[model samples]
Target: MSPSLTFRPPTTDDAALLLAWRRLPEIAAQSFSDVPDDIDRQRAWIERSNARADYVHRIIQVDGVDVGYGSITVTHAEWRIGTIGVYMGDRRGRTGIGALNFAPMLNHCFHTLGLRKLVNQIFDSNPRVLKGQALLGYRHVGVLKDHALKDGTPRDVHLFEMRAADWAAVRHRFGLFRDMDANVTG
Candidate 1:
């Protein structure tokens, strides 16, 4: 069966699923916060993020099933700069679906939102994320050593970026933005 992926903004209805996904041990380990077991905290977080104009939280769906989340935050400045992050729920990992979800998200950020640059920071240990980012036209900008303390140990983070011009130039190499007209019509 051919599988299709899509993304939509998160809503109150997705709070439980998001909480569940976040609760997975592997997912929590890579995230900023340990997944909260309390529903109230999850609801509060959702409410706060939903109210913020600068934050966007989206649910990624594969074959109409919610499988992951993608977020982008616009940096405050005259220039159009933003940072993006993605997390696939435990069950969705290693399935090569993350990129499918990421494609439209990138398109939306650059084309629909008019952003000039998008940045991604991946933990040095997570080569899977690094590969996914590279597949999406992000170039390795640099590495921040001992940047984050995960599980009480310092970890480095590799910074990757794709400028609007860079994306336009190398997008075809990745086949992500290739056949744009066909993707839009289908």
Candidate 2:
């Protein structure tokens, strides 16, 4: 059988798992946030995040094994805008499987959540993600020089945004099509 990607809400029980992924040297280097080492702190963060109405976090699994995480933080509710990011923790699952997570993520942000636009920020050091985002139809907005610090050195952050209309046009290439009645938001 072929592998499948799935997502579920993350709970405090996942603190250790998430912390381990965040602490991986490669993952830590690419992350804008500091690598968290404490389980209690991670648990607290999960708790706080789970309680927030504007934050959506998911633990990504491949055939039942947790391998990554994804999140969308609604930055401007009125404008239906949110910032999205994802990272894979399992090295075994990193062989192009991470890209599969993007479609569902985009579907959740644009289709399920009724978000009009989704913003993605990537560190200049991560060319792989930069290229993938471009190929997925995200338009480059601008670069924020010295936008973040990595290993004590300031780095640039490339901003990309995808409008619902833009995704509607290209999502089929990713095998994601629009569902006429799936986007109704109350």
Candidate 3:
């Protein structure tokens, strides 16, 4: 059986743990923001992010142990569109998990947050993540050619999107619901 997963709002107390994960060579390579080298800056950034109305950041825990992080930032409040990002900081938690870790975040964006659309961008080099995106029902929208410079070379970015209208099918395909589907139908 898969380990149970939970998520909670991240606080300044998490800054150190989050930063250590962010500093991991593999994790830092994929991040858009240059990982901060200082703990104080990380704490301050977490404080600022938590204060923002348009952003929701959470720490992902597996069986009560923090293992990852996820966030959704509303990019267009008028249109109810947002961008979502997630990474598993603890390698052990990532084993056999694939895209399943994103279930709660996806549901939150479409249902609780009432977001009309959610966007994601992945580097072309990361085929593993690209496959996971497909598993999660994200449709490839476009590619930004050489959009980001990584390790001194420009790299393409693939853009994917999930619409609220498509969430029902996705939720059903993945069996992410316990009793919510009945509520929706009834």
Number of the top TM-score candidate: 3
lDDT of each: 0.74, 0.83, 0.81
Name the candidate, 1 or 3, with the larger lDDT value.
3
Query: In model 1, where do residues sit more than 4 Å from their true spots?
Result: 90-98, 172-186
Candidate RMSDs in Å, in order, are: 3.3, 3.1, 3.0
Which sections of candidate 2 miss by over 4 Å?
177-186
Model 1 C-alpha lDDT per residue in residues 9-94, reported as the tens digit of each score: 78777788889888887777777657658877788888899898777777876777878887878885468889887788846533
Residues 89-135, candidate 3, lDDT per residue (tens digit)?
88756875556667777787877778889889898978888888888
Model 2: number of clashes? 0
> Model 3, residue 90: displacement in angstroms?
0.7
Q: Number of the top candidate by lDDT?
A: 2
Model 2 weakest lDDT span, ten residues long: 177-186
Better of 2 and 3 by lDDT: 2
| Tens digits of per-residue lDDT for model 2, 1-186 | 667667788988999899999998888899888955789999999999999999988887888788898888999999999988788899646775656677777887888888999888899989989999988889999999998888789999999999999888877776634222223222
Task: Give the candidate order by descending lDDT.
Answer: 2, 3, 1
